[model samples]
Target: MLFRSLKPLLAGEQHLQLIWLALGSVPVVEFAAHANPDALVLDLQHGLWERTTLEAAIGAVGMHVPVIARCAENSHGAISQALDAGAASVLVPLVETAEDARRAISAGRYPPTGKRSAGGVRPLRAGLEAMRAADRDVAIGLMIETVEGVENVEAIAATAGVDYLFIGTGDLALSRGTSDSEVIGRDCERIVRAAAANGLPCGIFTANARAVRQAFESGCRMAVSANDIDLVKEGFLAARKATFEC
Candidate 1:
């Protein structure tokens, strides 16, 4: 499976540069795949993705690059749907407690490990062996964004079956009622430490390449470098400015 390539990043041996896709376009997804990012995240939370597009996008790019679905919520249905759509991993947002972590993790596994029902075109086509492989290879990530989440980071990290802990810095800043970098940095550091102590890789949502570098330096193995929509806008603005200036 293409997702097997991601094992190194998950194992903390290499840094992962994830490109966030919010536009729900297969062409865009394919373009991102050609660019060869470590992973492409289909943002179902804030992105424009319905079931059909999500499945299509995954189908188009899943063979070349691993597609990670950032589920809109931390629920069994949401997690299962993403996996059903052929997402190599599922990122559950707003996870606030150890129970929340467990719930998200459970939604991605099979019986005895999770409650994920056997369905979805990809899994069905792949057959029983694929189902077993999905149970073992499908990565589950929990976002630590709320104040309660930061407070309980250690326990959340300790939760069994958790593949990685991701820090949503934007929401976390709002939860704390302060955008102070130092304060958020402290919380991020704490989360990273907890993940490391538990022998799991940590990931962070970063705004740019510099932030991604900073995140890696702080012990996070994965970082979202940028989203497709923002990159589009930036490209247009830069082109306009360059044309006018010239």
Candidate 2:
């Protein structure tokens, strides 16, 4: 029933690197945890994770490093399931307005602050103190990826109970109907400024180490630099090239 909290890392000024896990393999998650990144994100939205595997993956990595569950949608069921599975934080996607952000926050929190139900196995096993700790520490993050989201970024950032803001750059680019770096960069910068003005940490989904570093330079405290599937592909390609050269 032990839970590792990500609040300490989020509160600091240092840049935090997070590995995104979408393959839904416990071994892959376990290996990522061993790499000791600042945190690991379980992508439930587009990932291959089922309920049992999600719980098992979190169980395997929760003690080693904090886990942030990126819910499939901004809904109570999605948010609660992730928290119940022992994720230290929940990231809700497609948050286009302040109301959307509020809804996500309400879903992630418990009792007076939120409407999260209390029947998860972890809660029952951990008891009152652990539940209280969860209420006090579990972070709720909202993703700003749509044009509407970027338009209302400031209001979304100011929403009470939102622990952080994340930019879904791929979706953002798609929403804006352009892949132009300058256009995307402007929106990212705007979102970062909005988060800073609200005194909250901002994060982004990056393609590589360079993007991650650029995100940090642009005021993002957290960055999802790589995901399991892409890493595996890269590894295979690199190994194949090396073998051929040899």
Find the 10 residues in a row with the least total lDDT in model 2: 1-10
- Give one digit per residue, the lDDT tens place, for model 2 in 7-79: 8888888899999999989999999988889999999999999999998998888977999999999999999
Q: Give the clashing pairs for model 1.
A: none
As for candidate 2, its clashing pairs are: none
Any runs in candidate 2 off by more than 4 Å, and if so which? none
TM-score of 2: 0.97
**Ten residues in sequence with the least summed lDDT for candidate 1:** 1-10
Tens-digit lDDT track of model 1 for 1-246: 524334446875888999999998889998888888999989999999999999888888887787788999999999999998888899999999999998998888999778999998878888887788767878888899989999999999999999888999989999999999999999999999999999999999988989999999999999988789989999999999999999
RMSD of 2: 1.1
Residue 202 Cα positional deviation in candidate 2, in Å, after optimal superposition = 0.5
lDDT of each: 0.88, 0.91
TM-score of each: 0.96, 0.97
